[model samples]
Target: MGWGWLSYSYWFPRVHSQNVPNSALFYPAVDTDVTPCHYRIPAVYSFGSYLFAFCEQRLDTSKDYGRMNIGLRKLCLKDLGRCEDDSEWSKFCQLPLLEGYRTMNPCPVGCKETGKLYVFVSAINAKIHEAEILKGRNTEDFKLFVTSTIDCGESWTPWQDITYNFNENVPVGSKFVVLGPGHGIELHSGRLVVPGYFYRMPSSFTEEILRQMPNGRKSPPYNNVGCSFCLISDDKGETWNISTTSDNFTYCVVDNMYRHMGECTIAETVPGKLLLNSREYGNGQYRILAESEDGGTSWKQGKVCTQLRDPTNRGCKGGLAKLVLEDVRYLIASNCGHPSARKNLTLWISQDDGATWSKPWTVRDRELCGYSDIDTYMDPSTGTAYVAVLYETGVSSYSERIDFISIKFSEVLEKCSY
Candidate 1:
């Protein structure tokens, strides 16, 4: 695989687990047949009594080697077992969600106040080939776009490109921008927020450095550093504002290359405060943390989170969800517990906002586990609550299949040693 992309055989068996007693059900949301290359970056949200899952459907097209498009599959709360039928699930749109562009990172959010669902995606114009990018050819920068639905996942509005809105707020030289690739949150006050990052390209390009570059370089063409921020909407999904970027924070470097903070997750830890958990791309061993006092408008400098570890400096993406159980607010996070390997997918509970976390409960111990998203729902009939996790897993590699696991609140409280 080029550019360190993981490659898995097409014949890998679909692995599903229901061994956990509290897990109501576990199954593979997508297999190799649905996407020949792989189904990557899963995002899920609950709308009414149904759960919707979205992923980047990777396939080879005539123009691009493995072009990606957003694909969706849904499950009914009343009958999780029936999702196995091919006809039960359907795409959010008939054609590619963002046609003609290389789409990635599907971040979906639902607003109870408005009864609408929104999906945010990042795309780069794939005009240049991979070989060209490796050879220091400058490709077009990324653009942010969004789509919304009023009636669950039945239909969606056309893609609304919001690149201009983002570019207007970012610094003049900012080159690329991307969103949560997982799920966003609607604060109790009705404000919506989606965590994201932007890469600031070098101010000036030197011909000498460009000419001296070696072949097969994995980094982008320009010497860029990523900074985390958030996209906030005060008037629902009609408009958005880019929060202050976290560029003042001290970034770590390894091998003379700057490590950038990227792909963050945000949760309203308190009434007016937000906690941003970021992936450290540098020598830092723990996830980066930043605080916002006024909703998502501005952010403080990021610091290393001593408790959360990211081994080998290759930080993995994590999921954060807010749960209120028995009148106590809790924050639950899911990530690979190990620093270096994407194994031991564990869930941690935080009772005092995010100041501290309890011991984690291992969701998947040994197999390959990677990017994950968490969403919660309360059954109206029984008043019982459930948390659904959609993640990447496989027997040999994490890209083999996307899986789902539903666990009850009672099980978490009993298992989590708070």
Candidate 2:
């Protein structure tokens, strides 16, 4: 709640009738059990006729750390690329949890060549909080695992520990590494890219320093740097590589202590070009934008996109997706439109490959919302393109419900009023 200057809210001159789309309550919060549960971090993936929604079911509290499991709901598109009806979605089901560990970050990528759905998750010791990992307290407390479903959501392969592939190539001084916490992308060349970020421990970090720190420090560890990149897999999900080229990593300058990049999303702008959109964690209210020419291997220097405004202090997670309309490409994104608090969930469109974006149209009308994922599909038979969003929204807080909404590309074009 101590958003500080980043909590500056933009109040429009006038309020207009909301152009809300058709949305269904996909994952509603539960208060019936002794341990009330709330769903957060929504990610949506579309494969064939099914669209899968995934989130973290925080049992007992809405805090990041606790007993958490990945919750999934499968929706069948009665008509290809359509899921407006709530009846199309299946009941929410809790995914199998790693014993003694809490599973977070539901990053799923579908393979175009093999038709398999892969979900990457971070398994952490339930007792080990993110603060401990950032402080280098116990590197072994974090691990990365991925599971796949060849038959859609009907079944899944056993979880495979892929931590070695990452741990071995972590940046020289990285301590904390995490997955997309959203949906991943499969490029045209069949390269799978999972958006990720890691924190690099400064040379000043030491056990003695940890002991000397204040009991309840509010700010992040001093001098610790955060960077954003993608995890690449060439031969499906058989093996992986971290994008470590000098140009591949994106982070803000060290002049500001709290200005760090985190929780990013990626999309292929064209055949050989890629765009990585990340949230600036500190007082930087603008969304950070970076580009790569050769898939996810390397990236251009990152710059803040003034067109997209993010709430200050741990900016909310947004979704990115690309769609081709009559040979023209467009990038669609969703996030909190407000500059100060987590409110005014909005949708934006970039026509010139993210060079500029239209003024976003509010999606939630001042409702408290957080974390969203955008996915698009074109009906083969009709050639009609549609975009779908899975997001968390509530009146008083973000821990209310994860909702699903879909609108046509035609509607997006009409709604994106410059």
Candidate 3:
């Protein structure tokens, strides 16, 4: 058990650290006209001896607000520092992962038991308009889909439409549904869970206008209310089901904050227990917590974890993962540790499940550090444990490039200790 370190407050004093030593950063340079922004929500999955990473390659920004195609790259876990040689990374496909629709938020999960990898993605009809949305036209325009790879991402199956699986259980008037822009989880018992959210436009236009208006709102507006949930699949990626959605009313402290449970990440705390850490827009500094005992089919609201504070009250999405070293379980989280800006990208450790966390170990202390994803890679030959974080970083803004940093298990333990 990892309880020996539980007595001490895990929170370390914020230090002006610079970067993780022996880490490499990879940047993909492309002609801006063809690809405007990478729209950094990068996801990494450790399969066998290789690591697969993905991001949204935004194309035609002038026309489409955020029209992008999924771009994938792979690197050997043993050769992290050598990724800078463009030839070392491979871009398997140029065509959009899912065509005809505008896709965002790609969540990738791998099942070692079945040796299959699943990628869950969300898409909205690029041509749909606000007027049509208001009239309940093409309400299913915003949907979730999944594609899988049995050959370690060398090839992928056709995009499978799984929107109906969630729509059947979503609340009335729900107009939007999305999956994690990060990675998903496969429990010890072989159950697959992908974190996601569903939302409906408010009855009154005021809430919608206030929330949607600021982000350069235009003709086709986005939904204002978001309640997080998990898409659970027991039969691998063949079939799926929806979990009980988070209770927004009771979980949120302020009435105005009720509608904004944004992107989420899930990790198994123990044998049968799962913890969900979600991004709350109205209350950005604190992350919302929820728990599920029955394999993510049902969830109970947990209090806000002020110990896990992000930079801004308008919180940005982060990454979470669970690791076991020497039979001691630890949870690792990555996010901007500040409370007002997207800087001080740090990694936090929790020894006692998700109850408490150690002081953050700075990953990158820069202004434009945005969304990130975490995954563990264990070398079978030497039994070495390594954690890799794929995050967004830039000098002036958040969207210049996506970088991958690999930290050894010893490095994490050394930095997390007092």
Among the numbered candidates, top lDDT falls to: 2
lDDT (tens digit, per residue) of candidate 1 on 151-256: 7777789988888886567755555567887888888788998888766554422344334334343343345656788888889878887855533222333344
lDDT of 3 by residue, 1-418 (tens): 7766643234334653557642223344543345334546788878766788887776655132457677777877666542333455564354235666877678888888778988877777777643465456787676677888888777788888887886556655566666897888889888998888755555533454345334432222354555677888888767887754533211333333352676889899997788888877664567777788876877775457877875555688888998998899998888877667776678888898888887667767544677888888776656678888888777786666777777777788678653
In model 1, state the lDDT of residue 191.
91
Q: Distance from true position, residue 161, model 2, in Å?
A: 1.0
Clashing pairs in 1: 311-339
Question: What TM-score should be assigned to candidate 1?
Answer: 0.80
Candidate 2, residue 250: the lDDT equals: 65
**Residue 5 error, candidate 2, Å:** 18
Q: Write the per-residue lDDT of candidate 2 for residues 252-301, one digit (tens) a residue.
A: 54333335688999999987689999988777778988898999888775
Candidate 3 ranges with C-alpha deviation above 4 Å: 1-13, 21-37, 62-64, 81-87, 95-97, 129-138, 201-223, 244-251, 254-259
TM-score of 2: 0.89
